[model samples]
Target: MTGDQLLIFLAGIVGGALRVGVPFLFVSLGECLTEKAGRINLGLEGVLVLSAMVAFGGSYLSGSPWIGVLAAAVAGALLATLHGLLCSLPRVNDIATGIALMLLGMGLAFYLGKPLIQPQAAQLPAIPLGFWSDSAAVRAALQINALLPIGLLLAVAMWWAFASTRAGLLVRMAGDSAHATRALGYSVSGIRIAATAGGGLIAGLGGASLTLFYPGSWNEGISSGQGLIAVALVIFARWSPLRCVGAALLFGGAGAIGPALQSVGIGWGYHLFNIVPYVLTLLILVITCRPGVIVPGSPTELSSNK
Candidate 1:
């Protein structure tokens, strides 16, 4: 490839990373929050799809993207709360509950999202940060959605809050050992419930970003397992919010492989490119899941440690 061609290819990769990273960022951050509180919600895939449908429907009806986002967040929180309640019950398996919630989320999204599949909703507006660039390559590289900045900001804030604040200390304690937290006169289950709900809200907002901002439309297949991948990303990121952003960008870049290849007139490997994200995810898992690698950061009471 010529110099200009290589530059264009790199620009496309960057654009793709920005475009696809938003969902992963939101979901990974949400999962991180939930995990910090000593619980896990694997039903984010369903939450994402349902939120996308609801956000689109709200936007379609009210002609207001903000309202749609709020509605989607509420819906996601409700679903997450349900999962929390079920998991909190004695003798209930959190993993099984999460799987069930995932199935339920997908079913509900499919049923309610049918009408939205045919309609076009108002898309979230983008802010161009690259006006200084006269070249097409520069412009494309800088054209990013607002969520990217928001996600990064949230990650920084959350990391600070979790590491430096009193509330963060309590959350960390609760997740590390529920019995110990209770011994210290803290409400373990209560903390987990609140965290799970907040996580759900963020995940819902992430889903809304898909319909209202990124793709700018609602459809039955809007999510495509992005939520599940986000869960994996949290593990790969070692539960650090800042690391989540980097992991999201990596996943997003992998996802851009097919389009980037096509742009360069390489069509035969399109299907192979589609698997890049999953392959990268697996690689991350293998590298991060060593016996001692993730243990230092993981909640001590968490079952995944075993």
Candidate 2:
């Protein structure tokens, strides 16, 4: 490939990393908080889908993208709360509850989003950073999403809170040892429920970004399993909030390979390139999940350990 083509491809990947990584970043950070509280909510896929629809619908009705984002967060929190409540019951598995909720969320979204399929809602504004470059491709690549910085700041905030707050200590204690948490006079279930709800709220923003910024649309197929993949991403990051940022950008870059190549007039193996992110996910999981090898930061009560 020519130097100009190579530069364009790289630029596209970088831009895509910032763009696509916004959702992955939010979702992974949310899952990290949830898992840190001794509970796993795989229903994030459901949360993501439902929020996307709600966000779009709200934007269309209210003529305000911000309100749509708020609606999405509320919807996501409600669904996540239901998952927490069900799992709190005796003998109810968190993973199983998540699976059910995932299906439920998707079904509800599909049924409710039929009308949204044709509507054009207001989208979040983009920050243009490409004026320095004369090339149209470069200009397009530099149009970063406004939510990206917000997600980054949120990640930093979460990491700090997890490392140095009273609530953070309680969450860690509950995840590591339920008995210890109980001895400290804390309700383990309450902590987990709160964390799950908060996580869902954050994940909802990711859904908002998906519909209101990047893809800029409301559709059943918009998510494309990003919510599910985020579970693996959290694992890959070893539950570190800061690492989640890097992992998300990496996943975004992997996802951009196909489109980047195609943009440069290299269409061969486009389909194969499209699967890079998934392939990378499997590879990361395989490498990290070794028999008899415990993940250092993983919650003790996580179902994977049990």
Candidate 3:
């Protein structure tokens, strides 16, 4: 690659990371919060899809992308709340409930989103931070979604809360030892339910990004399973919100490689690049799956920990 090409490629990667990482960032953070509360929500894929559809529909109807985002968050929180409530019942399994919710979310999205396939919706505004760049490609790449800053702040806030707040301590306590939480007369179910719902709300924003920002469309296949992949990402991050941000950017860069290469006129094996994130996911699981190798900082009550 020539100098200009290299610059363009790098620019593409930076842009792609911001765009692709938005969903990963939200989903991983959501999973992190849920896991910290001693619950797992594997059905986030469904949440992502359903939220994407709702966001698109909302934007289309209201002519405002922000409204769409709000709608998506509400939709996600409701589904996640249902998952939390179901799992709180006796003999109910979190994993099984999550899976069922995932299916339900997808089915509902497809059924209700049939009318959304061809319609256009208002897209989120982008911030042009690369005005100094002479290259159009670089400038284009630097046009980032407004939500990126919000997500970054959210990560910082979550990390701070986890590190230095009474609520965070309670959440951590519940996850590490329900006996201790119960001893304190706190309702473990209440904490977990709230965490799960909040997590779902965050993940729903990721879905809104899918429809109102990058790709900026609503379709049955909009999610591409980023929701499921985020679960593994949280594991890799070891439940740290800041680490989740880095991991998300890495996955986003990987997802961008194929498209970046193709933009430079290198089309061979483009599909291979598209699968980089998935391949990375499998490799992470394999390496981290060793018996007796407990991940430090993981919640004790997580089934995977047991």
For each predicted model, how many residue pairs clash, with residues at least 3 apart or on different chains? 0, 0, 0
User: Highest TM-score among the candidates is held by which one?
Assistant: 3
Cα lDDT, all candidates:
0.83, 0.90, 0.93
Q: Which one wins on lDDT?
A: 3
lDDT of 3: 0.93
List where candidate 3 sits over 4 angstroms from the true fold: 304-306
lDDT for each residue of candidate 1 in 166-266, tens digit (9 for 90 to 100)? 99888888888888899989888888888888898888888988998777887777887899888789888888999999999999888887877676666
TM-score of candidate 3 to 2 decimals? 0.98
Candidate 2 runs further than 4 Å off: 303-306
Ranking by TM-score: 3, 2, 1
Q: Which pairs clash inside model 3?
A: none
Ten contiguous residues with the weakest lDDT in model 3: 297-306
TM of each candidate vs. truth: 0.93, 0.97, 0.98
lDDT digits (tens) for residues 1-306 of candidate 2: 998888788889999888988889988988999999998999999999999999999999999999999999999899999988888888898888999999999999999999999989999899887778778998898789888989889999988988999998888877888889999889999998999999899999999999999899999998888899999999889888999999999999899888889989999999998888899888887987788777777888774533
lDDT of 1: 0.83
